[model samples]
Target chain A: MTLQRPVFPLLAFIAATLMAAPLQAREALASWNDGPTRQAIVDFVARVTTTGGPDYVKPEERIAVFDNDGTLWTEQPAYTQLLFALDRVKALAPQHPEWRRKQPFKAALAGDVKALAAGGAKPLMELIATTHAGGGPEDFQALAAEWLAHAENPKFRARYDRLVYQPMLELLDYLRANGFKTYIVSGGGVEFLRAFAERAYGVPPEQIIGSSIVTKFVLVDGKPALRREAKIAFIDDKEGKPVAINAHIGRRPIAAFGNSDGDLEMLQWTTAGAGPRFGLIVHHDDAAREAAYDRASPVGRLARALDEAPQHGWVVVSMKKDWKVVFPETPKP
Target chain B: MTLQRPVFPLLAFIAATLMAAPLQAREALASWNDGPTRQAIVDFVARVTTTGGPDYVKPEERIAVFDNDGTLWTEQPAYTQLLFALDRVKALAPQHPEWRRKQPFKAALAGDVKALAAGGAKPLMELIATTHAGGGPEDFQALAAEWLAHAENPKFRARYDRLVYQPMLELLDYLRANGFKTYIVSGGGVEFLRAFAERAYGVPPEQIIGSSIVTKFVLVDGKPALRREAKIAFIDDKEGKPVAINAHIGRRPIAAFGNSDGDLEMLQWTTAGAGPRFGLIVHHDDAAREAAYDRASPVGRLARALDEAPQHGWVVVSMKKDWKVVFPETPKP
Candidate 1:
């Protein structure tokens, strides 16, 4: 009679939990291979969450920042934002007659990839300026969203959204499940990233920090809007990443994920904090599953960050060795 | 047999819900007396949250920003940040013999409020710069935390944290419970507010936006730290509020709450955005329980915002009539 009540409650609890498990339970980061990289992530999270553990960090202080382009999705061939800009320029070329002869525009109009690459940063800036400026934020967001919906990756012939690495998607979910507030700190245009980041990443709009052009809050034809200006306000790359992160987040994140040299400073800032910290870089070394060019790649050069990784104790996650799959497979009709 | 199985599950669900009711259910905005202001707040929230209502706003876009000082807590006599600065100046007097004769420091050390008031913005800036700069972020956060815990409001003799208005606390909780992401957009020092706001208001550091001084990331004896500098990076007052909001949040808030002219631009910007918006100004009109001053008060002068509130259809909250209590009651010994 004394043991019956307790045993009955325990049996009921187990039965209830089992009934709920099918719809509610999930294996976090299931796409990640069972390896050292996965172990380090899981171990760090466990250490921080353990009550009274030496490395225990409070749930509220569990901040994690991520770099978008190369880290979250494929930035190979070119950044998705850059590709959108190129498409916009081509679509609007007829409106600007002088662009028929201009170097970057000329190459862009002809879809000449080599000529555009040879022109370098200056031409890239011109392309960004022409496509991005002279509009309200809403208009820019709409254009970017429209392009992203229809744009296809050349090699995979899949929508840009589908090109996201399955492993990274799992990482974001895992971090959130562990009481971490995840943020996207990217070098891409702030407006461009805001367009789809919420839908694609499950990271909210307010959690994204990125490069921006100046904007003036004004009434356009009696409607309130933020008009984008041509002036470059901030560039969130390399040293600028740390500066932007401090200016916006105002707190040093405990964990950071990145893929290029541009993320070097962000990683350093995060890892250099007093307590336990995690830093991971996705090394694109698998050509079979995804385009793999680093060290010499113009889009996202990985040389400097790769060279410094060993000294800094940063994890270099080899996509080939650490992942069983790259992008999510398409659903059959 | 099928009917019996379904009936058992339904009974279990009802029993579970009944067990949860007492713990989960509570009155929102209970501190406010039955009035038009409370009704408006409730109605706006309900309309926005209704799935197919004309005023419905998505969960991600349901952003509400609040001013810190007079809106969330008392800023009477002096801003809380200013009070801390005065205390710091007095405390550090022994270390600096020269400060004994310096205008702001001398006035601060002497506890001569009239002299400090006469010294104007210049002296205030000097006090802020002297108290804030040169230290790393962690050290400053600790110092601020220590002071807030012990500092008492002179009039009420209550700890600074306990001086927060009960109605505002209810409103913050109510908004969050209704899927709104609340942010503190204030003109106070960002670092100072970040130190105690989280504990006091249940607002996290990342959600606080404020005026800032420049800080640089550096290696202090080979350990990385963000060292504060004596440069005003941004001032989030009047014209600066919208600019700061744009730079930090990137999206126009659906609602804004403030007490003074410093919040004029923020309210205008928020209300001007297309769709159902809410703007509120807390009229500090309770002289018996709290200080009552507007239009001419040197600290948190309410002239412009008060005048503009009516034209913008902003709700002016009469604290004396609306609030059942001014601050949280002291715990019984």
Candidate 2:
């Protein structure tokens, strides 16, 4: 219960641990091209980790938060969660035959993204409520997992999970190697993220904080289950990001990363704290390799945050120039 | 994420690690008297940890939750957090002149526990809203820390942090040492517990899940800050515990410990999961060492849970018989 921080033996211990696997440790961030952006990340980690330095932070306080959608993986064309809902609408169409005439469900069934967008948040919420609820979380997780297994990104001709940027994966490894506890602070549903984040990003379910629907404990057939409700419990976006961060993490993070304005407040809240801080925005400007819509995009819009990045000292990572690889090497069959 | 469970070299590694500190690891639960309760705990841990055994569990799934108030410390006379709120009323009485006549405030100012209880939950809620809000979490955390530093339990004549049970602390350490992530699931306000739980119990802020007030991000002096609002956001007790667990942790816990009926649903939810699970209830029957009033006690009432523990296959530890020690030895000045 003492307020005393542990001694500086930590730095030596960390150095020795990394040195034990010298080649692997040094080659971290291999997908990141040698440039200012990557160097800035490396420098920040070194600065904060250097024992007895003014910017040094103890390992316990080395918290790093990253947004999930475009920051960790692809969010272009549509959010993967939205795609999952549309697929669910199609799969469950027989159970609810009225969907053939319903505006959202009819559009969703026909794969009409345009019509679904026209209905705005109400129809989207209805889709989410109908598809994502009325079952236990484990049931929903299984559904999501099953979908993710066979679901492919049309443009990449690869599984959606495989589209996770290799550079970002390297960055996650690099930060964790330097003693950072990485957390995914996403606008996506927690249940949706938890289904694949551990295997995809090495972030565990407990470490994944996100927007969620209200869930209630129920006794179904004398067995305990968490029944997902139609109502949204919280939306972890924009200003809600910082609020959720405080509510879930308690401590302010030392680093923040995102791809859109939805993460602006999280960056602001994280960087506004005293001492060493970091904020990075991933810019999707690689059209050939992946979809590059930003400011005008309905999903993962990058506007206000892009304009204010310079003032806030946030590093804007241009995907076209910064990453040597857009995705990991596909495993051979 | 792939559903692939990691192969079990884990048991060998765990055995070697434990052997590295053979004496220390073997005597982990030193404060517990050699009895059925201690044996049950050791056996459950071993059953789940043994490689290739039917009950073997992966390290990632080894989560354990403990109820805070009476489970880990003395909630005698009153819950520590309520006592803190009462003190806050006394401290801030000068600012709120109207509180002199306000029923709850008047009762709080006079330290009239009975009068405050007589007014029921409404008065208690008013006390919480008035004294626990209108400030940033950091500011409130500072207030709680300041109070905790000076506050002492009259019965023990020791600081509140010093009143944490030695047996529970050992249990926390044992779980963590065995790759289990321990979380404090409490009905007490998250902010209040976060201020001291980390230092007192080594459970970090993020790992402490509890009831919370609504918080929003606001700019004070053009800097981001989360202002606590005067509203109850969620109550994490009974059913709420499991609901909060699924929301915050996603995965169901493998082990649960509590001292009251408030934790019954959490125990049920954890035990009902499709795996080997363990639940324990602490029976405060050692009046000579501590206070004893379970079935009828207003604070930390343990009636229903005690009656149902047997059916749920939960071990009920009699404090007088099971524990060889209560609180940890006070540090020398």
Candidate 3:
């Protein structure tokens, strides 16, 4: 089949004009307060996007990766996924009787945050594995969506998805407006993240890189289903961040953003690349609005990265000062 | 930073008008000969893209996956990657004196296809592992590009990249023009496909899902590098196609195209979904233009898929009758 030839000149002129509209009227990073942190981001984008400039990167090569949890959304008091897992344990306690007596399960069931934290990563990993498995990918997505819809953060008194940083949303929009493809690289389960990332952040499922469990293709009563297995396939944290980025993205990103040490290596690997690069860390210092434990905190700790940020030319974004407003609906501090 | 309020009415109208141009004058699947096959493709696209229609899929859900090897290009005489591996074995033969005595290596060195085939997938896998590994991803990409630039298909005497099917190229363009995201879900090495898929086929690296090797992130003299390990990570073929699709894309595709049984499950998974779906198999029956081998061929064997096409509603496209031309530059047969 062939299309009728159209009046090319008029259509071409219109497309060209419309294409230039975003460039002329870009309200970029509106939630970011006027400071070195915001300036650094704007400057880096300008340098890379300027045509014929030394640091100019092609649109195809202009890739930006963002760490999700604390970087994009809230990961206070406890990681959101951990909270989900704990809630899941309580919900499923009737089915698994041994969970009522098990250490992590017992702690989870009793809502003892201190005891759950005391057991360390092993118990947290166990909680994740048990809760995030046995269902098909679609089933898991539905389950996560259902929980996320009703679940509220105790401190914020709002749904977890509603707690996404307004500054980060603007940053994402700003980068995309400048022709940079933004991807979410998180330490959380990919299935869990996919549930709300699209609607909450505008990041698509294919653009999300996160830790995942082994998902097998099985025939369940003649229907093909991707069964999520109780085994970790990859962990997109620390050094694993760079590894997963390469495995999924196939190229080094020009810019990376994160809030914790889990994202340290990703920042290192991204900024270490030749040519113009950027790495920014979101330092959660807004205790008035959100929890602020960082360096010594078990979840989303920021010790080594905090100390090494300056050396790597990584900008540490002070959440309390740099962001005009934390959440989309939150009053400006 | 805030953008000045601009005159938006004019630009919005222009954008709306341009967006409707493709719907009005879509020159779709030009290289496809007019037949039931072309009609099926066009009809499926129309059904899914029609707004307010019962089968109308959202733009985000209009994902179309394609198998890379036989479906997109000529995998005649031998698969292109296998041929590259054999050539690499020859190129590196001087360094490895022990390969002179090794059965598979000896067979590879002698260009003994029958003997190599007799060794089954093991020797072929070993060849892939040994030849494709031992370098960082960038280095491997460079190596692959260097080889692909020089390597020629013995049958066609054309570079492998140059042998991509014209009809398939048109189909890709058609799908993209109609708001469908096209992805290459291949059994070939992801790195190998990444080397040329972007430039040659317009399919980006992230969108190219395929077999991969384990890659590690480590510091080389304090410089971060992803060290490509010589271990098979995942094979994206047969059932693995759906598995990898779910892992990478996190959703079932609306359309799938392939020329071998390796794509059966992917097609099944796509078409069996509860909506408008399309599955196409390219039957390479034009011996004068391209090689014709189906059920008995060791490489790209098409049997079960061909047998099940009728039941699954997959359109079987005969290269001789349904395609106006084969390769991009090849004259109509």
Candidate 4:
């Protein structure tokens, strides 16, 4: 008996050709199953983009908001950004005695992963407040840039940037190519994501709307500076996503993508539009190639969205079944 | 003997191709008779843009600003926006009685073109104040949009937009195609230009820096509104151009283009850079085809800059000789 492995090179070549082909090529997403899931995306993009197409949205009105963590990139085990902050905290531990006594930071500093995980959302939020807040915008930017340059993913032993999903990169390019001004509306700190979003995602700083600390423009030591205040201006998560989208973007997004119950409001807001709209959920079902957990997962629980996917006419993409490859080219163990 | 007149189509096709070609295809100004003028421009841009180019400005440091009236678009005879405002004034004349006796309004209502031009800069500024300053942001935007839809150029009978110089439009596109983020640093009200600039020019509203009337974010009739206040925020012309550029854009432009002495300070600021920069002055020298005036032209005078063209490295383009065509074709006439 002879066994045949899928030809990786030929598959990649086909994928590249399909992506590079002009928009007229319907073959790009043709492999998607013929179900309500796929139809939602195809119909929304078509109606909104097509001129004189009933749901035709003008170029100025074509705003598409996206969640960064778990949606655009892999955010399992924990968010890649949070991992980077933890590494920074560990590296700076010798200078601060306060962190040594803190619950989450002490667990992180002592190399107690289980203990840190046990601390849950409250302790994680505290860690974020210590590292991401208090610093001025410039100082926060400098710190983020430094971490981005040096931080490596513990699992891959590669730079955190190398872990970005290639498929999502193609989707971002596709949306922008289709006259949609893509924005990263996320729960991540706005200043943190802004430092590298341009170079990594091709989305400029002004286009980013995320959780942010209040900042005041002031003349400090005879020079202008935007001082970071301790107060949180907004938290762009859960129901806050819809409120932030209305306040900042000033328009409802024609398309929205997410992977968790945290994104339910955003998906609802996007689909509620009078014109064409799309809502997609990425179901993490591949435990072999990448970490996969669903309703029971503590970090990125899909819960309500997962249960409601069938009734709501949303595209639920099963990662294990759909993606031919995951995380680009990682060496087989 | 037979006389040959060039067909309009053949001439137009050649001009369009020339305008669309990449800027590098154009000849360098090195061979031009104006030596110092050419050097000033080249040096400024080079220093600010080059990596180790003496003025080696970083990406964040690359801020180039421009004046709209006379500098960017044609502001001869009367400012195009003001003409729009005057037409709006006439449309709204039936509602107001005092306008019939007012000097500028009387000049506007009586169809007295000579008297309107004779009113000069002060009366023109006052006219703008009366029409533009009292209205809130939304009120002004609606007014500008309404006026632009109906206002016709008195000379051409085409819309005022049809009167824009083809060469200037090409120049704006050319500058943006380069690394420079071009900004409109004009004395005209910011909200006025911002209303149509994004569509007319590719510049976004956030990138526009101009003179502003003070506005307060207030709840009016239980709705949030930006109310106009009778106060000047920034005047962006003459000596004020450089100050506004420094204050808002925060970096000197490596390149500057203007058609009048009103842009002298802006040209100076751009040329002051230590490396390669470019300063171009459009000389309206085609009297038969278009209005040609230089030293004594009241609207777009090029006197002081014209005198110093020999000492400064500025490229004074002769519109008649340098450009094959002045304006784009307007409906057979």
DockQ score of each predicted structure, in the order shown? 0.25, 0.33, 0.40, 0.06
Model 2: residues with Cα > 4 Å off, grouped in runs: A1-26, A100-103, A115-123, A331-333, B1-26, B101-103, B115-125, B331-333
Most accurate candidate by DockQ: 3
Q: Tally clashes: model 4.
A: 22
Note the residue pairs that clash in candidate 2.
Answer: A196-B1
Task: Give the lDDT of residue A228 in candidate 4.
Answer: 64
Q: Native-vs-model 1 lDDT?
A: 0.79
lDDT of 2 at B58: 89
Give the per-residue lDDT of model 4 (tens digit) for A113-228.
54554444455555666667665565887888888787777766766666666556656765665667888888887777877777777887657777765555444553333456
For residue B262, model 3's alpha carbon misses the true position, in angstroms, by 0.6
> Model 1 Cα displacement at A15 (Å)?
12
Go through the candidates in order and give the C-alpha RMSD of each one to the true structure: 6.3, 5.1, 2.9, 12.8
For residue B313, give model 2's deviation from the true position in Å.
1.6
List the candidates ranked by TM-score, beginning with the highest. Answer: 3, 2, 1, 4
The C-alpha stretches of model 3 lying farther than 4 A from their native spots are A1-20, A23-27, A114-122, A330-333, B1-11, B15-20, B23-27, B117-122, B330-333
* Location of the lowest summed lDDT over 10 successive residues in candidate 3 chain B: B17-26
Q: Estimate each model's TM-score.
A: 0.85, 0.92, 0.94, 0.54
- The residue-by-residue lDDT of candidate 1 on A110-194, one tens digit each, is 8776566544444665677677988877788888888878889776787888788888888887777666889999988878888
For each candidate in the order shown, give its overall lDDT on alpha carbons: 0.79, 0.84, 0.84, 0.65
Measured with C-alpha atoms, the lDDT of residue B62 in candidate 2 is: 94
- The digit string of per-residue lDDT tens for model 3 on A1-333 reads 223333455655655545543332125677788888888988888888778889999988999999998899888767788889988998888899997788778889988876675554456667787888999888998999999988988878888888899989888888887788999998888999999888888899999988888888888897777888878777778998998888788889999999888898999999999999999999988899777878878778789999989899999999899998888975222
Error of 2 at B280 (Å): 0.7
lDDT of model 4, residue A236 = 73
